[model samples]
Target: MLKSNFARFAAVGLAAAALVSLGATAANAAPVPTEGPLYVYDGNGILIPTAGHVFDWNDNISASLSATDMAAPFHCSADATDSYTFLAPQGQELTRSAWQAYAPNGFTAEGSKDLLAFTLSPYQQTNGTQGVAKVNGGKWSLGLACTKDNGVNYASSGVWWLPVTVEAGTGKFTADPVGDPVVGSPATIDLEATTVPVAPDVDGPLSLNVPVGAKATLGAAALVNGLSTSTGKLGEFTVTDERALSKKGWTLTSSVADFVNGTNTIDKKQLGIKPIVVSGTAVAAAAQVAGSATGSAPFAELAPLAAVGTTKLNADLTFVAPKDSVVGTYTSKLTLTLASK
Candidate 1:
């Protein structure tokens, strides 16, 4: 019995060992084949998530897609052929008129290809004082066609609003006379006009000169022996006394004639000598009368009373005295007057 029991025990131990070995082999064996069938396809039609194809967080798109051809907006251009205007007084010329171009945005500008081709119109509406006209401030506009390299050609039109101003030439007028007394005298008056481009806030004054005791002739110069000259004899004599006159807000300055000394003589034959003809009758005072003395007198009174037999006659007389009398005493007064012209 003991032997049979020991043999059964060994058999049981062998069975248990076999079971442990089987469990170990099963744990180490290869996994069973997957149930799905294998196949291949081009990645072209595959659907992709939008997030997968995004360039960045801001721009999301499918990774498998692309945008079609796109284009920019079309451009247009326009311009004014002429831009500047010039004005001038009648019988004047313009010095300069230039035009320039500018771009405010994406457009580009270049110098005109044909500068000489620009045209200018003749001056119109010419009055006695002013003239008006138009001139071509040369400029051009280019079209929106693509550049030679197939890039968008950014061309723009430009305009120039040039400032126009009037240019006047020198002008002239006749001169008018200014001051004097009434005497046969010579004087010069100046003729002038405001120069072109007159300075700011300045007005020019015209002036003239006349003899101390003479009047000026207006319009035309005085004629001497049919020849025109500034000097002319007065219609009446000027008073020996100084005088003044005013006209047109101007003063006529004048001077009186000066008298110094005198002598007297008488002889019908001696006074009537050739080139020395004695003026008819004279009084003792006649020889002494000098400044602006008018009228005639007989010589008999001018001669001193003669002795009953002696023919020689002599006379003492008082002469009109000059204000400042001396060796070279010459006294005169200046008067100021105005012009009417």
Candidate 2:
């Protein structure tokens, strides 16, 4: 009976040891540690949850037809202000600092604000969109903000639909006289805009006709002529012949005279005057003629009497011709004077 009792006690001790080992193994097989719930605060110190914090939006972004001109209108104006609205998910607000607007490569924003205004309406749990606004012109981009826990800001930006209704007006340029006249003569023409912009599109191209009032003037004409005397006389004589003539009158004025006479008494008349006799006898008698009259006459004939006179005439003349008169032929009417006794 004592041996049986010892065996029973040993068996009971073994069972207790097995139970302790099983409990230790079970404790070692426990699952890995996990992170706790997320809690974040915004710049405004607003508490935001982690799991259900999602941003939902409904946008009615629109573009309208604007003004058109010489160039295409890419800008939006008050007349063609685009209207649109967006709704944020419940319990979410648009980050004011994160809002941004963009335009096409060449287009630009003109207004100061990207969003007109953000309002909290009476609609419970409803996010209100902003009012109508204008873009300078061209392609555009819209960006919104989402900050759930404020740890790191979230951003969403994209290009909205392009506004195709607006267009640029065509332009044309013209002058009064297409061709040039005289170099100095000016042709007159009116420069006008076929279509003026009553309501200008800030983005649309403006058409302007820059009228160029220009003219090509002609240079003064030149003339050359050969001058000669009617008489065969060779000795230098005044150039009395008037040749240089212009619309403004004659420029050159002077008379030339040449004469030759023999020693024998010669009778001649000029300008219908009485004949005047140049007596060689009287001249020879006065000079003491020792040789025959014929011989003396020959010696006297060697030298003849000569006289010349020149007078300058006025250049100023009154006629239909003017200094800057048109280019054309002109003629002068005048009288010549002579002395005879």
Q: Where does the lowest 10-residue lDDT sum fall in candidate 1?
A: 5-14
Q: Write one digit per residue (lDDT tens) for candidate 2, span 1-341.
A: 11110000000000111101111221111111111111222233343221222211121122211111112122222222232222222111222222222121212245411322121111111222221112222111121221111212211221112111111121111111111232322335556678634335432211211124322122233331221101111111121211112111111211211111232221111101111113211111122111111211111111112211122211111112223334443321222222121
**Which residues of candidate 2, in runs, are more than 4 Å off?**
1-98, 101-135, 143-146, 150-152, 155-341
lDDT per model vs. reference: 0.20, 0.19
How many Å off is the CA of 297 in candidate 1? Answer: 29
Q: Which candidate is the best by TM-score?
A: 1
Q: Give the TM-score of each candidate.
A: 0.14, 0.11
Q: Which residue segments of model 1 deviate by more than 4 Å?
A: 1-148, 151-248, 251-253, 259-327, 337-341
CA RMSD of each candidate after superposition: 45.1, 39.5
Q: What does the lDDT read for residue 83 in candidate 2?
A: 23
TM-score of decoy 2: 0.11
Best by lDDT: 1
